[model samples]
Target: MNQVFHRFVEGIVRETDSNQEEREDLYEELLSHLECSFKDYQKQGYSNEEAMRTVMTNFGDERKIGQQLQQAMYPYRREMMLGLSVASLLYAYGVYLSQLLIMGDAHILWLVVAVLSSTALLLLTVRPVSSLNRRLWMNSLLLIHILIFFYGLLLATDVYHPVSIGLTIIASLILLLAIVLVYRTTIYDFSSNRQRSAKDAKRLHFINITTGIFVVFVILFFLWAFLFFSAEMSPAVFIIFIPLVIWIVSYASQMHLLSRQKKKWAYSIAIIQTAIIICLIGLWLLGV
Candidate 1:
């Protein structure tokens, strides 16, 4: 009987990403409910196994419990996606008009906006898939973002180096194709599974912090290169790389924390990241 109770409680906990307190509360409630069911079963002269079966049956489906918990915890993601979609369309239109008014090529500006919009859409849409699909989409997006970063780098070097923009354009197109594929993949994987465990969430957060740090280092390294080795670099490099670095770092930290288990390390990483971003922005503003 004790073993039976333990198994049932473990099932509930496994099905939801409830915190320890919430799990404890649910366990107590389930125990009380099961105790009552057991007493009722004994009164009806059922055997111990039959009583346990009856108790388990009345506890209802673990999957349903998981679904309800997910809905309760993440009710805002869908709404957020909708808002971002609308905003992206509006921003794209505005950029189009600005390009027409400027009466010159605005490919780089439009591309940057497209990258931003696509990233937002991916975050809102691509998450919450089966493990296999999730990993695939994540890897594809990682490649796409890397390519976009390099595309900007190429554009910045074009004026000084005058290399063919053909390869850069081709890479950008391929990145767009990848984004489209991932977007289509997301539409089919909307059903919720069990939420990520707290520990998994924490590890993901750590990854984000590490990625953000890497971006900052990259940006600083390039800035130093441009200042000290002006003969080998162009000022345009800073313009494109700075924003790319900042955007990547910011979102990496944010989503990483969102997916992780809450912990002291999570909070500490967040504080440090915020401080770094603030300091960088301040220095940039002061033109230092």
Candidate 2:
């Protein structure tokens, strides 16, 4: 029975990419189930061969077990993939819109509306509670992308500033980082042990909330400076926001989902954000 359990566990590890703790738990559960089955067979006065056959048969199909495990481990994989695809399409639209904004052919009011709408759609898709909700949000994202793309084509043929190009580059990078972090954190939480101490979890949550608020302030400051103060857009702005957004998003997701695990990635993201802020401020002070 011990040898059978060992072989069963080996098969599970080989067939799936489950983390060490999960694999062990699954192995133990299967062993317990099999032991119970063998006991039942013994009560029926079956021979050893008959008992083995009965136990194996009662265990159900191995493939079915694998499928069940996969479902349990990754119930959200499909939703995540769908969200990623929507984000990518929206990003492509943003690229188009940037080109239009550069060409000076697109109206600023329309561009603002399109960008804001697309961003809202992206956020909505990121947290839909159901498949129907996700589909609706995805459709909205796709529609916004199409609208932005056409608007961008019109702008590309018009006169616009080169500085707009730099701003677009920065915005696109931030959006890309957002998509990557979302995908990675979602997948990691699904696969990792992610059991952390309450103290650690609280600390992580605090960091996430604080950093997220800070990033929101930075974003608002930029918006205010550009729209209200009439400040010229600069590459430095991108340097500041890209890492800030990445860190905040990563920290928030980790705090919410994987609070118990050692969050090395979250800390690394924070450090990167701080470095970028310092570099941007230093450059501005030097009159560059």
Candidate 3:
């Protein structure tokens, strides 16, 4: 294919969210059609450059066509983003109300998290799907926020206010729905004709980042316990740090694997690490 046709396909493919493999397939298919059309135009006695122009003109505007193709592939994308944005904002308000009513203090960190998440979701509604490098950031933030809410619920005392409890429950439910939306979009991304290694690499990277964030939060919690609650560094404390150490090591291994382009091994490590985390969280919830 000529440079004109190749560049045209490239333009369309850039507006798509398809992975490398799928993009190549699309490029080939579009190039074939353009070539066939050019030959037909040649039979009509048009010069080479004139034939190229005719083919391109008949194909329509590359950007507009690309955008349309994107919409066809992911029809409800804007709606879902908008819904999640509204839900996140509501969840943020609930968090603010609950903290004020229960702790009698502003939980600035969590409030910022909710608001930022909401803002990000809102912006995503306007942004093209292909514009974002990775969707991991939004999903990671939501997952962490959900866990924080769950932990708060677990640590609740009998002295909790009814209004606060009500707000927390409602907020948690809204956030859970938001999570469902996240899962749906993620599944959509994975369903595309992407390479397995490529998809796994993205997930592994997400695990690496999320686990590091969890480690920081755990350390801060421990520091707060020691300073404010007069807690000692007992065996129990060390026990809590055990999994964290393991997670840190796993993070290092994952980074090494990724650097080596051993994506499959990195993915395996990510799954095991995630399983361990889920098990630990289950035990904590069960009060074991």
Q: Indicate which candidate wins on lDDT.
A: 3
Q: In angstroms, how far off is 275's CA in candidate 1?
A: 6.7
Tens digit of lDDT per residue, candidate 3, span 172-275? 56546655655654555535454445565556656665665556456545644554566555555566567667877897798688768787787788888888
Off by over 4 Å in 3: 1-7, 47-50, 97-104, 129-132, 135-166, 181-188, 191-288
Better of 1 and 3 by TM-score: 3
> Can you write out model 2's per-residue Cα lDDT over 103-205, one digit (the tens) per residue?
5343566556656765565555444332233333443354344344334333333335564465455444444444343333333433434344544554554
State each model's CA lDDT, in order. 0.53, 0.53, 0.66
lDDT of 1 by residue, 63-177 (tens): 6665565456445434444444444444344444444444444455646655575565556353443223433444354444544444443433332322334434543444344
Query: Per-residue error at 189 for model 1, in Å?
Result: 21
Instruction: Tell me which residue pairs clash in candidate 2.
Output: 103-158, 196-260
Cα RMSD (angstroms) for every candidate in the order listed: 12.1, 12.1, 6.1
Positional deviation of residue 227's Cα in model 2 after best superposition, in angstroms: 22
Better of 1 and 3 by lDDT: 3
